[model samples]
Target: MRAGWWSLVATLLTLPLAARGASAQTSGYLDVDGAWVAPWEGAPNHGRALSIAPAIRRDWQRYSLSSEGAATLADPSHYYVQNLVTATRRSREWRRINFESGLLAGGLAYRGEGFRTIGAEKVPIARELFQLQARGRADVALDKWGFSLTATGGENFGGAVRQPWGVEAGMTRELGRVLLYATARADRFREYDTVLVHDVATLDSYALSATGGRAEEYRTVQPLLTMTGGGTVAMGRAELTTEFGVQQGRRMIDPARPRARKAWTELIASLAATYRIAPRILLRIGGGLYPTDYVRQLPQGKFVSVGLRLERGRRQQVDWYLPPDLPAFRIDTLPGGARAVRLRAPRALKVDISADFTDWTPVPMRRLKGGDWEAVLPIAPGTYRVSVRVDGSEWSAPPGLVGVLDEFNGEVGLVVIR
Candidate 1:
């Protein structure tokens, strides 16, 4: 099943240059995290869990493809792994609203021990299952006020996987360097029809209602509300980020497993901070406290993580532009047979230029008093291709130049060096 998917990803990564006459970029990262979940609500299996995740992503002109895999190690001697791949298409903003949609496919596997009904007695049985899943999401953003909405749904095939559907809406406000944001989400899951219910009271009630019914399928719903606000401040060689959030939700536990209640109310307050120790490495510490469901044994909802991120090329900047300050490009010829390149971006940190003439290495342009940028390069009269990086953002062809695909599978603007 995965062989075909990997092949599809390869084809998609290459087709942007072949079909669209443009270029693209491929990037990825690897991360490892460890945490200890103290015993909560007298749960049997509670201990340290280590997780490793790796991902690869490719970006084209208006679409992108990404693949990620994750594995978890638990103290109870169980194995769980998952792989997900997604493709997305982005649409240009109409007025102040932007839209995007994504399609995803994935697989999950779990190995554990469980009780199986045999004759009249339950016996321990090895539980190993694999599941395939496909999902889709649609997101909408109102650029004027930083409001967004998203909806997603997915189905699982094989084993005891649950079909999930969810929706989220959020908003963000930026005042100076401080950012405030909040989100509200609701998710619903439908379990497989073959799973047996282990909740004695719920099972008895179901049997009484159906006159001879055996529990087959179960449904769980969760509605959560969360709000967080934080900002990143540059402190000398490192950057410091702090955030606090409050979450309240109702989680319907798996009916196939015996639990305290059919649905439990969850309320937690969380605080997290991160310090960038270096350009590519960071240190993170976070913890949560249960206000309503706090138990003496699970005092620490704590975690610490160290992350290292590497990239091959320049980083993309936030695509934020006020209505009147969009970036544009222009070119002019000088008396000394030099080509003068100009870019108009009233609100930009820096603008850099790169072309085949420059060996594809970026060189900064001088910012003019008029809030634009200009760079004069000596070149013979000929046609050349050039790409610009605005404020260390993604490589893009400036407006007014002919768009052509680059060797990296992305688009660049064609310029006349004459």
Candidate 2:
């Protein structure tokens, strides 16, 4: 499904300008990505292929728009198009409410031969002769630890028909460096099967199908638990997460047979870990296993899989400017002395400076003296590259404070307070 792709696009598009170094006055970004996959159990031994996708994003405060498409080349080729738009609002403490929708379409072909459809069956030669799908989601977050809910729906418009709708709710809690989350969801799917045939003389072909009608509604309830923790592990900077879940469902078969009604229970477990091998490189590994059994039948399903990924990127710095000096002050503590720095501003200036010291990975900022802000970073006491952005403007510091040139729109100074 394109749910993962759409969700990623929406996250990047709606990220706060303050976090992305964009001014509240304007927002946008360009993203490029590629991937390759090897054969799995159900897939045949076809040479690896490559795929590339590009995305564009634009945001207006709480509203955002984004779109992306990908093309792939292989013995059997495929391509996909997708787009999404979202609007979100965040509370003072950063709780979020979001609404999003998008569309996905694609075609696939195999070894010069084209099959009826992609994702329907395995053929020496297959193609997405026809397919289009639409999906949407709505979700809300409560503080960092609380309850959240999401509703999702989708439809497939193609040679073979498929439509699904579902809703899920989850709760989360944070305990020190570890977090726990649980979720439950229920959904139903309506699917159609198509077939084509050829005969001699006057050859003719048509589609045949079966369906789970309204009376054939299939329902399932899944409850999942995930635990995540991050710290400096033996493999350097690393994080480990584990998830376990259970699903129970009832399946009704058409043409009612002796075993027309089947009830099954499934259990799933997964683990993921990422290690930063170097300043700019990271390695990730993940694996999952599933076991299932029918209540009144024999064991029917079991699956195990693993994957790895390596990534490298360079970090860059940018600048932002702040509004006029709004009643802010700075306090500097030298190895043996301390001094207070003050700036003059109008009486209407309502902003204040803050400082804080914590071991949090994403350190928090604290308000300090007038016009002054400070943070005690959990890093070794050495000169480290630092960048600062003010009031949602581009970053402004070091060599050039190249933002708005108002009296209050620049860096105060970089202090080394032992």
Candidate 3:
């Protein structure tokens, strides 16, 4: 329903900011995407759209909450909105195994003025659906594997009433800077009157609104089966992600009729790239082919998309220190009222430092020769807690700097900036 969708999305977008004062770890992001789409087979349904997705995650003592929302508006008045909020209760680890259970609430809606035309082609578009599910998850650190099960029920996926029941299991492993994952899933689906799958490449939010029919529903005994594999590689300022999947499912051969069943198979592949423009700014681009949407009763299509995202994870973070005209193991006053801090450990491979000012997030130092590190930074002419780790080892204070106990009962080095 367009009723409270925008208000809900506004709440989700501002939730992280509202939780900043809490003792929880809170982060959020906002994405703005511009999309263009064309029907995979038909003459043409080419159109332009704008989409926005706001997401937030909060982690507290023994629980966590994740909320995501989206809204899209297309040319000639096509609109869609979606929301998913999940709250999980974390369990105490038992012998290398961790467990979690949560409830999920997801909903979406879309509508356009009955018929929109491009050239001489007119297409109908109206979609909306809602669902709720309970999920249980288990993760084992021994092999870096995670399994999850969900019992779900929803309304208006394809028919008058949504077919319930869906389950998915996945595992992930990290190798160096690359992460690999695989998943298998099965879900029941059905459709009723209108085919709401609409256009895939139009706006991602459109797909999220998959709902069918006003009268009867299409249903079969078999569930949709899918298998997927994906990987992500992180490079300095850039990252690449890829996914490949195969889906086998049954649905109404013709979306209009509440008829028997038809089996279909499809291949899914996509690539996405992201570049960090700044601590809180990012640029992203992605596209690929899609499979049939049973909920909206729409056929499969291809897509390409580009977007910009603003992340809260690294907000207000400090930059890596830079080399300056300062001596190692000493401090010097630099131009522009800045102070230079230097290290002279020539045998160390790499050096990093953190201070109270940097929120204790380590900032790398410019290395010369073997391990001589130096960086220029600005700080008030006062004393502050500092710590250094060489080659990313345990934090410790070097000679000539005061050593004291920190809030965590750990040792920290003291640096005086003049």
Give a tens-digit lDDT track for model 3, residues 1-418.
Answer: 6532954566564755733533455677889998775445553655677888888877665798888888877764567677878889989989877788888777777665444221123456555666666777777754334444444454444223366567777787766457788988888754333234344344111212337422222343446898999998766457799999999986444433335556778998889998876555689998887776655434466677899997764121211221243234676788898876777654344677888856788888896553367777777788888877665445656445777767765567787765
Model 3, runs deviating above 4 Å: 12-19, 112-125, 143-161, 190-222, 254-259, 296-299, 313-418
Candidate 2 structure quality by residue, lDDT tens digits, 1-418: 3433554345444534323423332333332322333332334432344443434444434444444433345443433333334333322333365655555443322222223221223333222322344445555555446565556555544322345555677776555335567777665555343333332233232223233222222233222222222222222145677777766665433222213445655666667666544433345555555432221111222223232332111122211112343323233444444333332221111222222222212332443433234443333343222334333223333223222322433232343434
Give candidate 3's TM-score: 0.66
For residue 111, give model 3's deviation from the true position in Å: 3.0
What's model 1's TM-score? 0.59
TM-score of 2: 0.45
Best by TM-score: 3
Say what the RMSD of model 2 is.
12.9
Candidate 2 global lDDT = 0.38
Candidate 1: pairs in clash:
21-405, 22-405, 22-410, 23-409, 23-410, 23-411, 24-409, 24-410, 381-418
Give the higher-lDDT candidate: 2 or 3: 3
Cα lDDT for residue 262, candidate 3? 69
Candidate 1, poorest ten consecutive residues by summed lDDT: 291-300
Find the 10 residues in a row with the least total lDDT in model 2.
312-321
